[model samples]
Target: MKPFHHLYGPVPSRRLGRSLGIDLVPHKICTYDCIYCQIGKTTQKTLVRKEYVPVMEVIEEVERFLKEETSSIDYFSLSGSGEPTLHSKIRSVIEGIKEITSIPIAVITNGSLLYLEEVRQDLLYADVVLPSLDAVSSDAFLKINRPDEGLSAERMVEGLVQFRKIYKGQIWLEILFCRGINDHQDELIRMKEAINRIKPDQIHINTVVRPPSERWAVPLSQKEIEKIKNIFGDKASIISEFDRPPFSLTEGNIKEEILKILRRRPLSLNDLSEGMGIPTEELERHIQPLILKGSIEVRSFGESVFYEVVKEIQISRP
Candidate 1:
């Protein structure tokens, strides 16, 4: 298997099956330099969406991996080192993948630019969309998300609400709460109202699980998480990270291929594209067979999407 630094995982996900990740943007090129970001602060923060990396390059990588005949992947996710939507070619990448495979396409994002019609249009082809809303109040939003100047809580929520109206695919809204930050009663109540307006298929309530940039960012206990889940009502659940069975990559030993890449660190689609030198369209082709055999899964961390090994079929080590 050709290794790339950009894409990581086919790691074990609590949500989607062993998933194949695609990173469309470069490192930390996001609109928000969130306080609790796992990848650290954004070095270049902007709302501009452009072709940071060649779209055809991403497509080729996907196809190559798919042709490798690996198994044990589920979703073909668009994510990575930075905000995916920031890449102007996002829509084309999605379209290219759709041409290559029938497996569900997922996009994990921060939802900052959903207010833009073009941004919403770019997301139209995805099977699932996961976005984050960390705070309801502007003060808390600035402190928690540390959004770019002029981005506000109301605007972000409005964007999500509008996306909810037109999007036909499954919407999973992620809420990452920081202890003593956005977890207060008033914030939770306000968040509940916003969620109602968006009406997503699932409400994924989470806290800091990985090493974060800010020391103040901490994971909520299961008990505390459950409490927050209760506030969101039945549509919500606390994300669990635990042991699962090995996912089977029936073709070309996909689990082995994905694991070889993930052994270094958690990676994104952009990571894979750059690392593998395979076009994104080709990458999608490589991932489709694996998804059918159930080797990978997809999960959410705020707006980020990650791939994990499925727990059923056992995969041999590469």
Candidate 2:
């Protein structure tokens, strides 16, 4: 069976294995128009929180998925499309999931609203909160994230620090570095300072691997990534380029499975082939229908062609 509208995955995740992703906000509705954003630019860059999706609807889907499916879902990941915390009643969704199952909850956010006490309080029940911090300086923050006008790097860090103190779960702080932009010696030093304040349970370093919004958001070299690891010390780890195990597909529906995986983020044809263990020739049969049906679209990044679920009705292939 196809996944419910708001839910996707039980697809492979490097951080959370076989995660069932819940998309709260609409596509690209976020507080930051990050330069390196994989899903492209934020169409609605707002700090004003609202009920982007009905909390009860989200809860209903969660309940239904758990009751019907018997997939080995590792985490009930409350993340999809844009900012999840922006959903006004996200607390209810989190609490609702908790009421229904034993699966851990993860909220992947850009970490913009963590400065707000209400936001932090709402996320208190999560098993893990993966918040991102790509810049420490105002210039770098603006250049990299292009956050909502009032949202500054200092405020974001302050919120994260406060959350760390009160949060009872794991905080895997992610830092996305854009080469020559936020990966300089000075930037790393300032980043280390902010990281110390947050005191996250774990630190993750990530560079642009997938197709980013701007063509200029280049990937860093292995030597540079290793160097940053040294700078952040032991708690900091790089999100590996290597694929993780258990890309377990659903029982009988490959089409449903492909769309489910693509909805999370963009994946190259080879990425899909390698990760799903479907040969390129066989996978193309699946890909052809998805492309023809206007359910998914493709774009070229570096030397790879990446497929993503269509954001709008009109589809274009590159």
Candidate 3:
């Protein structure tokens, strides 16, 4: 198979299982520069929606990958290093992919653009829309998300409420709590009120599990999150590790495959093991050499250790 610029992984996901990710926008162009973003700070933070990447090119890549790959994908996810809904022609991309395959479509977004009716309409065809709402109070929103000048916590909450009205697909609302930022009692009260109005099918509670852009952006403990989960009630649950059985991968070129996935986002050893279906011992053999040659480095976040590509190094494909 030739290299694909727009598509990556049938990577294991905690929520979406064997998701083949499709990148609609380039890296770091987003509406918010989140403190806890694992992908680093956003470079172009704006609310302007345009064709960031060629729509046809993305569709063609999805078609090609579907034709060549035999793995059973659970969802074709529109998510990558940046906010996907920022791409204006996302509707066309969704429509184009649907014409090619029966695999369900999922869009993982920040929910910042959902205030725009056109953006909601574009995502209407998706089987599941996973949108994040980290804070409901403007103070907490500003402190945590550092959104564009045009956006507000009020408007963002309203957007999710409106989207739930028109969108019949599943809405898995994710809320990532940052210690001392959005985890206050007042913020939680406001958040629960907003969640009540939005009425998502599932409320996924998350925290800073990866190395964040700001070192001060810390995670709440599991005990703290469990308490919040109880407040959110029956529909809410903690975002746990992917527990499904691993999928099979074609043997050989394990090193190249590891680099490809790590270039997108950092992954723990278990994440690599589950996603690639490669045993830990075999993967360690491939990973040690890459670390020795300075292609990737390990960073610990919370209790888990993650492997991320060293940005300055240019790793030639093996």
Candidate 4:
């Protein structure tokens, strides 16, 4: 077995179940340098979007994997490293994958670029768009998200509100609450107002769970998460931490393989590391090729960066 390269997990997700992620940007290249980010800081921050990786190569890898057997993947997610929308070729990539498979495609974004018509157009094809709105106030927004220049809380909100007018697919808006930061009564009220305007299909309330970039970042108690959820009504729910034991893999497949390990539930990086005894650095290297090819992606809950495969990429004989 070549080990599944260019893909990572059928990893468990808080929002999307059994998602396969597709990373289209370089590591940590995002518009925001969030304090609680799990993947660290934005080493290269910009609004520029271009083809960071070849779409054809990614499609080829996905083609090979789907040929073997259908795993438990539920989504072909556009996420990882930094922001997915920053990749200029995202539209082409999304369209290309759709030509091959009918798997529901999703894009996990920070909602920074939604103000741009181009950005909204690029995301229209996605079956679901999971965007983050951590704070409604600029002071708290800067304090928590640490976004790039010119990205204001008011401006970001406006973009989100506008995007909804045209987008027909599901919009699962996420709001990550950092204790003592954006998790106050006043802030939540403002967030509620914003949520009402956008009227997303789901309001995913999240907190810092893993090791965060800032030491002060803390996960909210179950009680606190519930309180916020109440404000949002039935569509709101606290994000549950997904945990699964890792599976042991053969030594030879350690480096090149991108195994979509069979699991009934979600798995974490610790599970994969401990279960396979693969060094963290080695595991990253194995997944790097996939990320570069736009076949895999990375996401963080706090300090932990989890990998998933992109399900949208499928190959067919002409």
Which candidate wins on lDDT?
A: 3
Candidates' TM-scores?
Answer: 0.78, 0.90, 0.97, 0.78
Supply candidate 4's per-residue lDDT for 189.
90
Pitting candidate 2 against candidate 3, the one with the higher lDDT is: 3
Q: For candidate 1, lDDT tens digit of each residue in 1-318?
A: 675444555644556655677878877888898877866678998988789989888888878777874454678778776899988879999998889988788998999889888999889889999999999898889988888886889999999999988999999988888788898889899999999999999988888765466767866677888888987899998875433444434445444555555443444554444344445466567655556776555555545555444544555443
* 8-115 per-residue lDDT for model 4 (tens digits): 555556677666767787778898998888666679878787887777766776676577644446788888768889988789888988888898999999999999
Q: What overall lDDT, based on C-alpha atoms, would model 4 receive against the true structure? A: 0.75
Segments in model 2 whose C-alpha atoms lie over 4 Å from true places:
241-252, 273-281, 288-297, 310-318
Cα lDDT listed for each candidate = 0.75, 0.84, 0.90, 0.75
Per-residue lDDT, model 1, residue 152, is: 88
What ranking of all candidate models by lDDT puts the best one first? 3, 2, 4, 1
Q: How many pairs in model 3 have backbone atoms within 3 A of each other, for residues 3 or more apart or on separate chains, i.e. clashes? A: 0
Instruction: Return the clash pairs for model 3, or none.
Output: none
Worst 10 residues of 3 by lDDT: 309-318
Clashing pairs in 2: none
lDDT for 60 in candidate 1 is 82
